[model samples]
Target: MIKLISKTALLSVFVAFSMMKSQSVKEILNQEGSFRKDTIFSIKSDSKETYLPVTIIKGKEKGSVFTIVAGIHGYEYPPIVAVQELLNEIRPENIKGSLIIIPIANVESFQKRTPFINPLDGKNLNTAFPGSSNGTPTDQIAHLITKEIIPNSTIFLDIHGGDASEDLLPFVCYYNRKDIPENTKKAHDLSLKSGIQYVVSYSYTLTPTEPAKYAFKEATQQGITALSIEAGKLGTVQKDNVDLIKTAVYNMLENSGNSVKRKSKMVNQKSIVLLNQQDYIRVPEDGIFYSELKSGDKVKKNQILGYITDKFGNKKHDIVSQTNGIILYKVGTPPVNKGETLFCIGYNE
Candidate 1:
C-alpha cells in the first residue's frame, strides 16, 4: 500500500508541474469574443542571445486592422509607456477590429539604452523596411515587421520622439500626397483628433533621410492608412505625454465608428520651418550660438536669430532669418557650427 501511495503522489506532482507550465504560457496569450491576443513572432540576435517580443491582438468583429508600433528607437520611452497603458486598457469585447501593439520593436537597443542603430548590427531598423529574410540582424527584423506584420494591418500608427540628444515639439506627420486616399485621410484626421498640438503635412521632398520613409510610402501604396505620432523627448518617459497618447488611442477606438472630428483648421500659413528648405535658414559658421529667439518666435528677414563665436573669443558667424515667419525649432545647446541647422523659420508665401 505504501508503494502504491508513493507512485500516486509522484503522478500527482507531474500533473501539477504540467498545469503550471500551461498556465504560464497561457498568461502570455489570451482570447475574448472576436479578439485574439497572440505574441505572433519574435526577433532574435545572430547568436540567439537576445530576442525582441512582438504582440498582436485581433478583434473578432469585422471592422478594421490597426497596428501600433513603438520603440523603433529604444531610447524613446514615451511611446512605449503609452502603448503599454493602451494594451492594459483595451478590451476585446469592445473592439470591432484587430489591434497589433508592438510595444518594444528594438529590445536590444532598449536594453542597452541606445538610440537609432541597433548596437548589434549597426543598422537602423526603421530604414531597413520590407527587409530580406536573409539580411542582417536589424534587416531581418524589419523584414518580419513589413512582410508579416504590416501587410496584415489596415492602419498603422508609428509612435516616435526626438531622442535622448534633443527635445522636439509634439506633432503628427503625414505625407502630403495630392492623391491621398480616403482611408489615409481618415487616419490623419483621427490622429489630429488625438489632441496633438501640431499637425504637420510633410512631403517626401522635405525629409530626405527619414528612416521610416519606406514604411510610410509602402503603406500609402497599399492604400492602408498610416500616420506617425511624435511625442515627448527622447530616452525619457514623460507621464503627461504618455497619458496624452493613451487618451488619443482610446479616442481613436471610440471614434472609429463616427466621423473623425478636426479641431484645428487647415492653415495655409507656415508656422514651422525645416532647415535648408523652402524658407528655413542655416548657421553660417561655427561658434558659440546665442539665440535671442525661442521656438514659435516670429522673425523678420535679416533679423538676428543668433550669433556664433569661436573658442578664442572671436565672433565667427551671425545667424539671421531669411524671411518673415515663426521659429519652429532652435538649437538648445551652447556650441553651434556653420552649415549645421541653427533654426527653422516658417513663413507665409
Candidate 2:
C-alpha cells in the first residue's frame, strides 16, 4: 500500500509539472516580441513584382508609430541608403514604438535607374498625392501611402536628395503655418534633433501640382508631425552623407524613447536658418550669369547681386536684389533665359 501511494504521488507531481510547462510555452508563443514582415502592396505587372518594399518593426512595448519613407524619386539614392541603414540598425527589443520603413516608394522609377515621369501618363510620383484607386501606377502607389500608411503614423520623415543634376544643401523642410497643431510642432521639434544643416519652412501654396497635392501637408493636416529631409546629389550615393543620415535617424529614434542612446549629440542647434520670404532676381534677357556675391554673403536692396552677359561678353542685364538679405543661391551654369531666376535673397526681417 505504501509503495502504491508513493507511485501515485510521483505521477501527480509529474502531471502538474507538465501542465505548468505547457502553460509557459503558450505564454511565450503569445508574447509581443514576435516581429513580423509583410508586403502591404503588390505590383500589378505580368511578372507580378513587389515594389515599394516596406519593413515594419513592431516593438514589444506600446508606443508611438513612426513611419520613415524614402525613394520618392527613383534617382535619389542617398535616401534609400539611409533608410536601409536605419532598418539594419534597429532592434525589436530596443524599440518602444512601431517603426515602418518604406525604403523605396517609387519602385518603378528605381528599377529604371532613371527619373521616370511615366511617359504614358506624364506623372511624377512625388507630386501625386492622395492617389487614386484606379488611376495610373504612380497614382495608385500614392493612394496606398495616403490611406494605408499615413493614417496610422504618429510621426513621419520623408527623405530625399538633390535631383540628378543638382546638389542640395542638407536641409529639413517643414511647413510654417499658424494653423499647425501642437502634435505637429512636437514632431517638428524632434526632427530638428536630426542635426541637418538647414531647415526650410514650407508653404501650402508652393507645390500646386500632383505629388505636392498629397505630401507632408496631408500628414500635417492629420496632425502628424512630418518633415522632408534632403541629403545629397540625386542619382549618386554618397557614403558620408548616408552615414550622417543614419546617425540622425538613430538619434531621432533614441530621442523619441524608442531606442537606447549611442550618441550624445544628434543635431547641430546652431545651424543656419534661411527664410524663403525674399524675392528672386530674374534675368531680363538670355545671357551668361556672373555672380558678384556668394550664397552666404549679405547684401543690400538694389545691390548688384550678379550680371548677365551675352556670348560676346556684352552686359545685357543687371541682377539686383529687391530687399536687403543674404544671397541664398545663384545660377550654377551660364546662358540663362529671359525671366529665368538668377539669384534668391533671404530678407533680414
Candidate 3:
C-alpha cells in the first residue's frame, strides 16, 4: 500500500521542476571560485549545429554579474584574442564580482573564416538579438545568449572590430534611447569610464514601438545596462588593438567594483556621436573599392572618400562624403558589393 501525497509536497515538487528548468544561469552564479568553462549546445538542423563556448569566473565573494562577449563577427580577431587571454589571466580569487566571457560568439563563422554573416543561416548574429528558439543556427545562438546568458547579467559588453575587409577606429558605443533615459545614461557613463578614447552615442534607428536589432541595444531594452566596443582594423589580431580591448575590459571590471585596477586613462570627455545610420555611404555598385581614406581620417563635405571600379577596371562612381566629419570606418579591401557600406563618418558635437 502507498501513502497519499499532500498538496504541499506536490507544490514543492512543481517548484523544484520549474527551478531546474530555468535555473541554469542561477546554478552558475551560485558556484564559487575558479569555475566552469564549457560549451552550451544550442541546436542541430540540416545536420549542422551551433554552440556557445562560455567561461564563467565566479568570485570568492558576491557582487555584480558582468558579461563580456566577443566575436559576434568572427573575422574581427582582436576582441576574441583579448577575451581568450583574459580568461586565462583572470583568477577567481582576485575578485569581488562574477564575470562571464564568451570568447568567440560566432564559432561557425570563425571556423569558415566568414566575415559578418553566419554561414549556416546567412544571418548577422549581432542583428538577430532577443532571438527566436525556432529560427536558424544563428538565431538559436542568439536565443541562447538572450535567454540563458542575459538573464544572469547585470551589465553586458559586446565587443567587435573591423572585419577582414574593413578599417575601423577604436571606439565605444552606448545607446542613448530617449524612452529609457536612466538605462541610457548608465550605459553612457560606462562608455565614458571605458578606456577606449572614442565614444559614440546613437539612438534607436527605429521608433520606440519596434525592438532593437543590436545585441547591446536589446540588452538595454531588457533593463540591463550595456555598451559596445569597436577596435582593431582589417581583421588581423593586432597586438595594440588586443591590448586596447583587454584594457577596456579591465577598466570595466574596476568601474563595476570588481577590485581590479583600471588600466584606463581619461578620454577627452566630449560628446561624439554617429551622424546617423543613414550617414553610412554605400557602394554605388558591385565593384572593387579604392580608398585612400582609412578610419579616423578627417574629411570635408563632398570630398571623394573613395571610388569603385568594375572587375574589368571600368570606373563606376565616386564615393563622396556627405558631411565634414571623421571617417569612423570604411571598406579597406579591394572587393566591394553594391549596397554595402563604403564608409561611415562621425562628427564631434
Which number leads on TM-score?
3
The C-alpha lDDT values of all candidates are 0.63, 0.66, 0.78
Comparison by TM-score, 2 against 3, better one: 3
Q: Could you arrange the candidates by TM-score from highest to lowest?
A: 3, 2, 1
Name the lDDT value of residue 201 in candidate 3. Answer: 80
In Å, residue 52's CA in model 2 sits off its true spot by 2.0
TM for candidate 2 is 0.73
TM-scores of the models, in the given order?
0.73, 0.73, 0.86
lDDT for each residue of candidate 2 in 44-85, tens digit (9 for 90 to 100): 322223344667777777777778898888788898888877
Candidate 3 lDDT tens digits, 1-349: 9999984454444333222144676787786555645545445545565566777887777888899999999989998999888888887777677887888999988989998999998999988886776778787778778777778898899999999988998888887777778877877777777766678887565554565667887787777888899998898989989988887788778877874544455455455444333268887789988877789898998888878888888888888888888788888899988888888888755
**Clash pairs (backbone) in predicted model 3:** none
Deviation in angstroms for 272 in model 2?
5.0
Span of ten consecutive residues with least summed lDDT in model 3: 12-21
* Local lDDT at 114 for model 1: 83
